[model samples]
Target chain A: MSTPIETDVVIIGAGPVGLFAVFELGLYDLKCHLIDILDRPGGQCAELYPEKPIYDIPAWPEISGQALVDRLMEQIAPFSPEFHFNRMVAGFRKLDNGRFEVETDEGELFHAHAVVIAAGGGSFQPKRPPVPGIDAYEGTSVFYSVRRVEEFRDRDLLIVGGGDSALDWTLNLQPVAKSVTLVHRRPEFRAAPDSVNKMFAMRDEGKVRFEVGQVTGLKGENGQLSAAMVKGPDGEIDIACDRMLPFFGLTMKLGPIADWGLNLHENLVSVDTEKFETSIPGVFAIGDINWYPGKLKLILSGFHEAALMTQAVKRIAHPDQKLVFQYTTSSTSLQKKLGVK
Target chain B: MTKISIVAFDSTRFDVDAENGSTVMENAIRNSVPGIEAECGGACACATCHVYVDDAWSEKVGSPEPMEEDMLDFAFDVRPTSRLSCQIKVRDELDGLVVHVPERQA
Candidate 1:
């Protein structure tokens, strides 16, 4: 039996891009261990708004970002990359043996031949507006991204944000939710046009109410989001609701990667284009955290980048081995080996 | 539309119509080709849709831009031919192009 131990790579995030890296790494027969700060897969897409539908992705006609994440998680289910979750990566440094010493916020250190920074543009948590009395009710009625929609099936939900996620969820809950009130900082919406249109339609039909203003106060009664005080153009308004969803959109973070000593183009890790090698030698960057003139920041791009970086890794790991996976003899394993098939 | 043919390490080939404005990765996903994932939704965040430009087409495809270079650090099985298909735009000079998709995308 193969000894269950360390790995060739330790991916920092379980986001789509990071999971995609696992796909490429497995093809190379390279052992890897995946880690993330979140308790589950799908990274930001999972944490921010799993229920929000994503239209920009080319393949899926109309699927929620969370759903796409679900598919990706299924794809990676087979390899079973050593998953370590709810632990954030805090630091990393290369060793004399050419492996990486990856450290996490939980005070855990890892040893790996290489490290992939799939941290999904860094750690992200909801940026709650400056509202008083919001801290006291930490575990009660407040929430970030709705992990379970069933809980809100019969409760009044107050969604804040004109962005796509906020608007889309409002429309999604129109039928099942007992009541939904969408509050935005501005009259215009930043979400997709279709979602915005649906929100407007719901408002016109009296199924939902729209408040254009900023949330100034959040008051809770018995540890629940009981009511909200908003400053609208008209004047102060007190709204009653059971819960509030502050989907202010995701703000990309660079995290401890900024201290990695890699060259940067606007704080992103700079790499040697030919080898995908970063300034740190053994360390590499991939996915949206990476940038290019016309970088697509898509999962496909991350996959492609992983392929190239893998080649570079091969050269580094087995420099003397023939560049090709073939050795003139027909072998069943060769087909799976990443050599010319 | 440009016609680009992409071959995978597994010998799967794709000949799809590429829209003029989209990147190669974007085109592959739109064509319903199996190779590229375009996760992060073509934002260059994930390398799920990586591909290799055939030797003849490498120079024409241009070097990895800074952002693309930055993200390559995360991709597995990095190859010299590797280029994030999403970062490559479909243009006239690249009418007949070829890319290689890796076998696995984690």
Candidate 2:
């Protein structure tokens, strides 16, 4: 019901590819707004392996994932692209006038002349533990992330995982929950030592219980959980709890994009290499989320796709404008657009 | 070449002649061994390439390094001998290495 923010292009993912698209699109004076599921821009480069070195990026001998993302951010700064973080594009439809409308999960709408989907792999979603039948309790007695701390008040909570999410939530929710039990596969924790120590201190005081194990089963009725069966070192044991929070980590899923009626090859959107445009007019797919014959899922390939896609996007956004190819090294106009003139 | 055997959850066996310096995960993927997702492509980031080292070879394969150990925390049903196959490089000492793929990856 709210007014949609209008833009020349709405990029679906704020990964390196998407960030580079802003630079390409900006060269032609096209405004852009990027929406990403992550809190920051880097996508997998930030989430999965920020410190890991990436060797394939062109010209750079070696750069860490986070470093590459940082450099891209700097490269796109002149464009002043608007970023919508911690949001997912839930709805997408083409209007009769030939423009596109995208709605986020938070209900914000964006109207754009062209849409670029540079979602690498897909949207990063919280990984669900491999416990059998756990899906039945999702959104009710089981939750992967804590949106509000008040929800667990006076409820028995079982927190699973050895990472920061599990330990942080354990320490934060222990006060509100009637009881809190921290479970992991090993005694060693991957969380910060400070949080792990605080959790252990709480355990020593009998405020919480720390068990080394994995949750193998869940007992509940009609989406309400009562107990969790854990296989610990000693043996199998049942931990009684009404709520469970498992922080396994995150995995990429081809979520709402699959339902947008676009042509899909396997889980990837089919795009033409000429313009990187999908089957849908004025909509494009690039990076790992796109598929073509001999398409390689590399950052450099995505950058090339972005440059090519921008040409087509400019045509859709400004049908009357004459297209001119200019290199940043030679053109004063391009340098001015990049703010280097 | 080191001969490595990767056993899938359903008991499917793939024996690959893994070249030295190549990872066990690479060989499994080359042979199309099912269940070795290796989602992060041997970055030691995602733990989808989880496999249980055959008991006899556990000593020879050695324990996971600290980074791999941290990544294993994301794997499913991790056991004492659980290792990310991507971190296990093929070498002369690891000849005839046998690892069982887990029921599911993280």
Candidate 3:
């Protein structure tokens, strides 16, 4: 409903490739605004393996995934690309003027001359716990992720699952909650060794309760949870709690990107090797989401594709201008734009 | 340089020379070999670069590592000869490496 944020390009997904695209587009004097489902950028690099060492990056022989992302962020700082985080782009339409308008699930809208999809493996959505009727408590008593930690303060919390998220939050919320109880299908955990050990230490110290069971049912009224039925090895038991946090891990789905009408080859956006442009003329696909002959889903490959796509984007965005390729190493205009002088 | 032959599902043959220490997936991308989509680069993350090693080169190509085998689970078709091209590092012994790429990667 509000006036769409106007920009030269709307880049979906703030992953490493999307971040790099900003720099490439900025070199051509095109402004970019990025949208990501996560609260921060770096997609799989940050989410899955932030501390994992990457060996194949061109210049950097060894850099952690998160460190590489941080460097990219610093590199694009001069561009000042606008970032719209914690929002899922749900709607897209091409305007009569050849511009594209995209609306996020949060109701924010963006109008841009070109759209670049750098969404790595699509959108990551939390896998809901298999408990029946858990939907009623999703936004209220039950939560998949701890957005604001303070919201659990002084409340009776029942955290479930056996992953890093569950153990991490159990340790964090124990000191503040009225009582913190962790429920799992088994005593074992797939979380990090240290966190798992700390959780057991807390349980031994009587600071928290560890119940080996599965959450079978919920007892609440009008979206407020009062208790949860746990199916233990012996029998069912009800644990009183005001809040339940279940860390069931996350699954990546193509989400709204699948509905954008682009040709998809096995859930990946199919694009040409030359321009990285999708079936749609003004739309482009890069990074892990693109499919082409001999397409290597490497960050370096995406970087190469981003460079070529930017050339195409510049032509489409500035049709009247004679596009000249300029090397950043020697181009005074580029150095000035990058503020490297 | 090691000569590598990659055959697509349509039986299109691409013969290229790759430097030692490089990967089959890298050489395929460099030579624009069809049906080789190494989407994760060479990270062994995505199994897009799945290939079936030729019977003669099967033992020479070796078996996919545990990590590569795990990733192979996501590939289109699983066979004893299936290997992730990114994990197949080129070496002097692999001078005449031959592999067949699947129709598509899952």
The digit string of per-residue lDDT tens for model 2 on A162-222 reads: 9977888899899999999999988999988999999999999999999999899999899
Q: Number of the top candidate by DockQ?
A: 2
Clashing pairs in 2: none
Which regions in candidate 3 have their CA more than 4 angstroms from the true location? A1-7, A14-20, A35-77, A80-113, A120-125, A133-136, A175-179, A201-207, A220-224, A251-253, A271-276, A279-282, A287-308, A315-332, B1-106
Best by lDDT: 2
Residue A222 local lDDT, model 1: 68
Candidate 3 residues A105-134, lDDT tens each?
A: 999989999999999888976667657788
lDDT, residue A197, candidate 2: 95
The local distance difference test score of each candidate is 0.74, 0.91, 0.87
DockQ of every candidate structure: 0.01, 0.29, 0.02
lDDT of 1 by residue, A96-132 (tens): 8777788777777788878877775677666554456
In angstroms, the error of model 3 at A113 is: 5.2
